[model samples]
Target: MSKAKKVIFVIVEGPTDEDALSSVLKQIFSSAEVHFHVIHGDITTEDAITANNAKSYVAKRIAAEMKKYAYKESDILQIVHLIDTDGAFIPDNLVKTRTEKGIQYFEDHIETGEVKYIQERNQKKSSVVASLCSTGKMKSSIPYSIYYFSRNMEHVLHNVATELTDDQKVELADAFADRYEENPMDFVAFIESEEVAVPGGYTQTWTFIREGTNSLNRHSNLRILFEQENLKSTD
Candidate 1:
């Protein structure tokens, strides 16, 4: 008998984000055999951002958790995207330095699979957008203000509770189109793409060049490793 095929683990920022992406991916890859695992780090921002030591500790812990699910070289599609909101006392130089270190670390640990790091300067609002679009809404029901719209959405979803059906939820999403006049799916994709592009932005606009360098090195290693594997299968 053959071993059951392993699913690709696609880690995201948080549980809600995981759920949102999971829903989409499940629909898109329903017929495909790969499974997507979203890991929400157990540590809080306060614990992960206190100092260099804290950050390292959190990263190591997260890495250990991931190691538990490591698959055969040919079976795992390791894709991890971390969205960070640790903006307090963010110095320009710190971000750069961290990026460099992150890159170097990945270069050293390429065997561990691919990992994506996204340190968003403005993740709060971006996350709100991602979460809201996950809900299906109507055109007229969406509020005008992005802030107000998101808050109102939370309120409605909470009120509806289990009564919300997939079709009904999508109907609510129509309201977002009317209110923002932008495609809901497009909005979700836009925010997700932004989260993925955080490393590049760090190089161009961030302060800590060394950190940025580290992150880049790490990102490059992972990007290449995972994509190469994926290409082999697809090609």
Candidate 2:
């Protein structure tokens, strides 16, 4: 008998995030099933949903999708959420709580002199899972992980090519999609190479793609989420 396929669900803020992540994750989870569902909004808004309510919004959506597909909770090995950190302020209460809990959250000072908040991986995972299962409307317990781009999707692509115009960045993303479709592993290898680089003095988004000894190492939220999920699958 064929082995059962493990399903992993990703909830992204918009098409760009979905597209970029789908390309990378397809390679990362080659043996398993990965699904990307767009929330049709930025971190702040998608119809009536806001960043503060994203957890609830995603949980309801997950429940609905599960019902539609008749998938039990066990069928879903994990649920990952990707959102841009632009203008999405971390609640003070949350910050205080996490700090008190001794979570290792950090503040990244960007070139624009703005501070970007990164929530600890453990905190984000536990909080998201709690929010999802807390509804009590879903049938099974599903693990959850949340990640955020430093500023926005466009910013990340721009980091890959600081000299590129907005139009050029879009083209680059499309090229990445094409390359990914043709050979996912090769695409990952390309990302892992030094060919991808963020502009000096900017938040190092490329560090998520490539492991290096830079000060920004392991700072990529998506990288953390993906690595955690990968580890879980192995266990």
Candidate 3:
């Protein structure tokens, strides 16, 4: 058997994100080695990371990972980042208020005791997402693309809108991965279906999601990658 030609590094926010999608992606991109790196946190909303520096921060993270493995630029085929669109694109007026000192995310609006904080977060995160998705290449000179599960991974994949405990997340993720590991094409078909799959090409799809409550809904543009890769193969 031929070895995969290059590395397809995938950065995800949590272990469950990896567990839910890695096997399916690996099967799809069989020509390249798919490696998942769980960040355990959202890079777009990290401390001191604004839209202005988000691109550079991501480049740095990728560089650090590459250096850790001593993988040169030539070894990397591309970078695929998977993130959750927690309705950050919505306007500040949509950020509702609550008495509790915590944040609650819903499909249409976010409820938080600190409304101003949430607005600030949305501003920063939205900008970061916009910057990263502006083009198909990162500042590191490597091919890059990002996809999101609205609300969150669990909301999209498992159909559970409410937040899940860590234990519940692990269980659902394992079950999801197991279901698709045998027939990744089935998972592909599901991902490409009209229900959750947003219509349009790469850049166009991003624009569609930024409108109104769409970002909070269960939508994905992941099928664009498959179409792009298929075109590459034919070329």
Candidate 4:
């Protein structure tokens, strides 16, 4: 029998995230096993996570995934992490206050009753995210990279409505997967379209998001994934 295909683990926060891109990723990385591992919540914003321990935390998560899947380190190809920006990198002044408790994310500002809460979350989340971004490989020597969809994954995946129920999120993801299931490569084209694509190489693109309110707008640096796979996205 042929050797088992190496695993390409795509880490995400929840099922909707996995549902949205798992099919297309499997298609795109046909030579490998494309696995979507949902961690159930944003680890970046967790109370214990900080820049100091973020990598070790993620490394443990990856180890756990390997155990759960029965995959050896030798059986791993790479790790690709997909995260929502959630306006985490925006400056303090851009976060506007609100009467109601709901959080409303706009193109250039966020409206929320918990300004201090968001600010604290941002301080914690951004540092952890930035810590992850600064590294090219995990301590285990596995090739790793993180990509982002600003505001949230749903926003970049063609669903424009600001608020969605979990059921609605799943529906959108399934629909998106089906829309490109026949020609999953087309997903690259959609994400790389003029309006959604963040223009730059890997590091430069990350730099771009940290500037001004770009992180709150609808944008993504996922085109870099296609580029890594030697697939050119339309300019």
User: Model 2 scores what on Cα lDDT?
Assistant: 0.50
What's the true lDDT of residue 14 in model 4? 94
Candidates ranked, most accurate by TM-score first: 4, 3, 2, 1
Model 4 lDDT per residue over 1-235, tens place: 2237877889999998988788888887887888788989998998888899988999899989888778887677788999999988899988889999789998889889999999888888888988999877875677899999987999888757387889989899999889987798688898888878999898898998888988898889998888775222211
Instruction: Give the per-residue lDDT of model 1 (tens digit) for 1-235.
Output: 2225433444344444443345544443333333444445423243234323433443454356446655433443333333322221222333333323322112112111112222342232233323332322212221111111111121222222122445665565444334333343453343334222222332222222123223222111111222233323521
Candidate 3 vs candidate 4: the lDDT winner is 4
Model 4 stretches with alpha carbons more than 4 Å out:
1-3, 159-161, 229-235
Task: Show model 3 residue runs off by greater than 4 Å.
Answer: 1-4, 230-235
Q: Candidate 2 residues 1-235, lDDT tens each?
A: 2227767788877666666667667667866678787777643443454435656666778888877766677777777766554322333223332223223333332122111233333234334333432343333467776555444555544354133455665676676677577576664454444433333221244323222222222223443443353544632
Kindly indicate the candidate among 2 and 4 with the higher lDDT. Answer: 4
Cα deviation at 213, candidate 2, in Å, is: 22
Task: Please identify which of the two predictions, 2 or 4, would achieve the higher TM-score against the true structure.
Answer: 4
lDDT of 3 by residue, 65-135 (tens): 87787777867777889889888888899999999888887878889999998899888888899989985
lDDT of 4: 0.85
Selected candidate, larger TM-score, 1 vs 2: 2
Worst 10 residues of 3 by lDDT: 226-235
Worst 10 residues of 1 by lDDT: 142-151
Summed backbone clashes in each candidate are 45, 0, 0, 0
